[model samples]
Target chain A: MQRMADYISVDDGLVDCEVYSAAVYERELESVFGRSWLFLGHEGQLVRRGDYVTTWMGETPVIVLRSMDDVVRAYLNTCATRQVTLLPYDAGHAEVIVCPAHRLGHDTTGSPVSGQAVEPGHECLVPVARVETYGKLIFGCLSDDSPTLRESLGDATWYLDNYLLRENIGGLQLVPGVQRYTMPGNWKLLAENFAGDDYHVAITHASVLAVRAQGIEPRLNNSPGKGVGANLSVATGFQTGVPHGFLEVRIGEEFFEHDLMRAQSIGPEAAEWVRTRRDAVDQNLPDLAVKPYSFHVANLFPTLSIIGNGTSMEAVGLLVWHPRGPHQTSVTQLCLVDAGAPPALQRQMVWALTHQQSAAGVFAPDDHENFERLAENTRTFEARRVPFNYEMGLSGEGVDVRPPEWQDPRWPGLVLPRFTEMIQRDFYRYWRSLMDR
Target chain B: MVDMELTAAATAFLNEEAALLDDHLLDGWLGLLCNDVRYVMPSTAIMPAEAADARERRNALRWGSFGDDDRDMHFWLYDEDYSSLNMRVRRLDTGMAHAELPESMTNHVVSNVIAGQDPLDSELIRVRSKFMVHVVRHENNENTFVGSRWDKLRRTDDGLRLAWRYIELAHPVLPRTISIFF
Candidate 1:
């Protein structure tokens, strides 16, 4: 079996194809997913007592629920007795979970509640080691020794607050149902893409951008530094020591310029909402507000990815790339909007997410195709012999450094130019470190 | 009672529409829709069958569902109006919608058609049918989508034009990208 060093060389910025092999994948399920904090679902999904949503922590199915005490908790979804699934539904309100096999019942706390006396530990659902919430988003970890969720998130929270906990506007609320679909690829590929792969945007989504460009007026295009090409010149990617990373495109004055164009196309209300939200941000997170950057794509460690497009206030999507096997990933996508936003604005937000991020959307399908092809190509022995390149912005690699004036003293973590693979390299370095233990 | 003539007409219209999509003649397919066409496919979820009555009762008061598609407040796979639908077609025409660049060969099978004249409107018919869309892309990448569809067809000088459509895909988790229409 290949060692972690053989699979990934952070210094050389080369990744062996064997990183996606079954052996490596199995180890990742343990070292990476098992010990790390994994996103379950948002608190908005659990509005009332007994409300629960079923999701996966790695491959283990877990139920995240609001208990009778109004505290949020999670437990393995499998029945203690027969090992059958406790709840088969995606989400529902249940006072007591009854195992379909043999009429055993479990209370909201996952303790067996059937009339028959049960063994204390043998008949209770296994609880996850720790459950924590950052803003409204909930995460669970299987290892008791793992760092707290806040520590795992590290400096990434500074950027996430701009979107997750917007000022005065109550936190984000997910649209009713999740858009779940399967894509052919290793889960890491999708996570890395969101981490800091803005380079692919100009090429991978050329067709969608073309269609959008035709719809926008030429006047809107006058905003200096409007598109990806211009934004890349000022884009910044951050690598938190915890391995979490995000890419931010600071399109200075063009921050809310799209709203002006949208106002003409979609009534004045569009521009009004942007103004109100901008005021809230300015009043609350003055530091983040001052930074003239709105577009953000971040992968919080393993599978959770958050994307916020401040230009289109309604375009926020929370994605989970759940690993299915060595070659397949199941994605659960949720559209999030400010809970305090008007119904019309919320609807528009959902529309934006459905139009661009969902499986059938104009943008995601193209990315899915590329991921599927990558999975296929890397499956063969001959293909596995070749190494994938990740040296685009390696230090001293002749890549232009961001101008000194562009750097923000307030931003934490190792910030690099937008067109760099530093985040991906650091992400793999952290993964390799964890596996080495 | 089922209107046999209306059922035949609706079946023929649906079959022809499917044929146009299968042939990748998206523009021809677009021509069969009314000016204010609403083509929608709502995401589905799995729930306990025993909770059906409680869920339905709750759905009556609130216009959304956590375990099923709620037209008003839930997420949808596709919630396109005429303009959006037209834009999607235009996107494919660009020859760069990579998901369909080497477009898939599709076979749309429409069955179990049931149609009846709308009681309130003389020139409108409500129709329901089951559909199985089999698609094969690249070499061996195959995906089959099975679902039921509800449509409101309006009588026009040209023939029956689809005014509204609601699709309920059976799978709770879709197997692949829905690059092709249902």
Candidate 2:
């Protein structure tokens, strides 16, 4: 295996395909996933004491739980000594975590208790190095040396604030469960797609957009039709403009009124709450203002992404691109709503999530087909030789000139014009930096 | 109580529906539904079995087993009403639903069909059946989905029309894309 120095061959804006290779996948399991802050679960999943959910921190399975004191903690789902996986299912609230392997049991804090022939102070379940949160989104890191979640997130938090920490809808609550599915694809392909691949929307997902043009917006009707468009032209981020990009879907003033009516039909209070919060954010954060009907989609570093319908900030659509193997990815989705929102509205959010995102969603199939084919084609010897071009808006007439305002010290990271590959390029650069370390 | 004749008729209708799906006759299948028809498949989640409360919560989110309450809280794979189903069919008609580029060859195997009078509405009949869909895409990639369906059939002038259906998949993680109806 080549060291980090020769791992990538940058030819202009093209980078070597070794980043998606099987061997490098293993190294990433070590260098990237192992030492990076990974999204574990949302805090709302653990409202009650003993509420826990099993997730992957890299390839290693870990159980994150809220303790009796309400402090969240994470521990490897395997028995410390036997290494036998303790939990088999996704999530739940349990009084004690008992390993069926040896009858070993541990409290929420990973302290060993009564178990078959287990001695005290001999260790219980192995604890994950760190557990942290940002806007009710819980994250875990396996390596102690990893940066703090806030530090790692950096400018990405700015985008999260627009959706997650909006004034009235500050705390987003993940609904009770998750929707998970797998695809025959490399994980990075999906990650890059979420990061900033606006160019593929018109071509790769043309059919999805074509279906949306049929006119039955699912957000308004609670149906299976497309609700959002993919005309992603302008966006903002802390680095580039906030860490948020807008999908260029123009719903005229009449449609916006119709959308408001539909939102009221779902839940008047929730609709009013979202409207007030959205207006406040738009008014307060002038730089972060986006078009009313434009979808807000942003990827937070490694894999956690939030995509929403431009209508309201009520539903928080979360997707985690989990690396199962070199050739397979497990995509998990969670749609969250405010805890205080009406149950009917929460259900509507969940319903809207199904219509728009998720593995079984209308939009997902479009992106999945691309990622699956991209993964398959890249594995070929011929495809590996050709570098993937990300040279758009790099220079000349189409260069993404950085606006003068983003140069202010208030905005973090390198800023560039919207619709450029800068965000994705920055993604890889951060990835390369992590892998190199 | 439903007589064997009613059961036989329901079984035949299901069989014909399966054949229409296999033949990719979406319009024909759509024609069998009433205006208020709801075709839904609930999203499946894996809950820790060791925790009974968790399991109960998860199951509560899921569609109750056949004959239980029809109301469900879990997100759906396809919670399509008539208009949505119509839109979906129209999408396929456009021949632009790229996921079906080389249109998949599918076989819908339906079994364990039981028919009875609806407890709440005598005019509607309740039919419970299990289905296994064998989908072959690109002549190589094959996927099998096993699930149970509860259908509320209402007698219409045209014949017994499907009023509502709840398809609950037994698997937690589904095959890549469910681009076609079950």
Candidate 3:
């Protein structure tokens, strides 16, 4: 490797096409994303028995809907001839999914309803592979050999359940749709950024956090965003900090003051939601050492990440890693929410979840400006070391999360100074692993 | 008063408006509107068939005809005053509104104008046109924008001053940002 002093080069590209020629993105499309149990959607998406929504698994388009039998299903959304775009809209419910091109159609359960144009032989939106549902969570694949969704998640399901899934939990609902934002950088840059990088708050998101109000009438200096203002309680010290992938920050008590009981929808039942969310955050979250648990962001590799505490619906972001060229990547995120709720509650969740997390979100955008500038401007003519240092929490305190997400279970969260460089390091580490696969 | 001449004037008025938009002259674009003019884009929902029928009767399609295109909350040269428009212009100048950036360049190709008389005055005119817009930014490639536009023109010696403008964008998901004037 070159010295850290040298700047980044196109040669420092994300994919080493030569070394990993066999494990190309094409292979990833056919293998990784196709069979990795990509999240298709949640149960709330279809409030009615026969409603449906559609999404993608890598490049494979899939439809998800609640069948007339009340079962949620996932199926290859492509036409039998593979000549259709499926449903283009991000999310919508249809009694039956119809294709305009081949006149192919299917019921919510992936069964042929009509439009095949073929005889009674082969028909419908060809059931490409496995379709699985974990409560409201739905996933699909295009490969018959793909493992079940539970197998793909591996031991990580424990983390998912402990952190998410709760009773009266609103069933981990995805808000009606999502707030979309695109990040221009290396696709890995964003994936790793969300995977774990709490050290960035001191600089990248300093202003946004400095101005964040505790769900109250945040007193901006008579201005929307001035560093210091009347309403902001500035004197308190933040948390110490944690290692890579683990983050914690303090949130004030003056939060979760929603008058949902007066909302008339859940009304008295709203207390169950409050308890479920608060309990989940308090029990499951680990310390980030420096950043406190009051605020936290945890990402479970490759694509999915959540930004949340207990009460607030953490933005569940799905990354669309689109390679722009040899190095440029456009990472698009669709923040999820509970779709079963009424529109009034759903809207608030979308912005708050993403407003705190998306690439353009107050915090994420600041980080974006930094990474984009880093990636776009670093394509120099000469070789230079663009070493991203994660030495801060190394040994002195809050180093790296041991083993990192279920890959190894016994690792501890501490590193020597300039300690954990998990994301960038593991990215290359996994890159090599996939190449050999 | 509402003749082909009025149609000619409305075209020029729209042309100037487009020029201002291209030039990042937001206040100038808002200046050519009537205060009571409405500017709204209603939400699109695929409700049940029963509600869908009622919505059609209410013209609840993307832009509620009366609420968004005809409501009194719309701004113009007189009502918003220069300050309100200036504030809007400032909003564009600042890095606040992520929806659209003043830096984005645009082209509005307006044609197929349909003109009629204003009910309040025979001397006034209401004109509608179908437009195809093309926008380009440094980072993104050119994107086509399809929308229909309506304008109420009150003749001034300078030609015709705009009284109202209602733009109905055909593609609601919008390529990027729809910040410029149409």
Question: How many pairs of residues collide in model 1?
Answer: 0
Go through the candidates in order and give each one's DockQ.
Answer: 0.59, 0.49, 0.12
lDDT (CA) per prediction? 0.77, 0.68, 0.47
Estimate, for each residue in B1-182, the C-alpha lDDT of model 2 and write its tens digit.
65577789899999999999889898999999899787778677676444777567544333324322324455467877898787767766776666777677889999988888877777788888899999887646788989988788888778899988888888788777677787
The chain A TM-scores for the candidates, taken one by one, are: 0.91, 0.84, 0.66
True contacts kept of each: 0.68, 0.46, 0.00
lDDT of residue B25 for candidate 1: 95
- TM-scores computed on chain B for all candidates: 0.88, 0.85, 0.67
Question: lDDT tens digits, residues B10-32, model 3?
Answer: 77777887788767767667767
Compare candidates 1 and 3 on TM-score and give the better one: 1
Locate the minimum summed-lDDT window of 10 residues in model 3 chain A.
Answer: A229-238
Measured on C-alpha atoms, candidate 3 has an lDDT of 0.47
Candidate 2 off by > 4 Å: A4-11, A116-121, A217-271, A282-295, A338-348, A396-418, B1-3, B48-72
Best to worst by TM-score, what's the order? 1, 2, 3
- On TM-score, the candidate that comes out on top is 1
lDDT of model 2 at position A363: 69
Candidate 3: tens digits of C-alpha lDDT, residues A181-297: 344455556655655455565556444443442212121111122222111100000111111232332333333333223233434334444444555555444533221113244
Model 2, A1-437: lDDT tens per residue?
A: 66644645322456677778888898999888888788888777888998888888777888989987779999898887778888887887877888887787887787777776556557668888898887777898889986787777766565456535553445566554467787777787677677677677667656656666767655534212344322333333333221333333232344355456666766778677556655665665666323333344667667777776444523667888889888788877887765655666666676667766666666677676666566667778898789778776656222333445334444333434445665565556557766776
- lDDT of model 1 at residue A118? 76
Best of the two (1, 3) by DockQ: 1
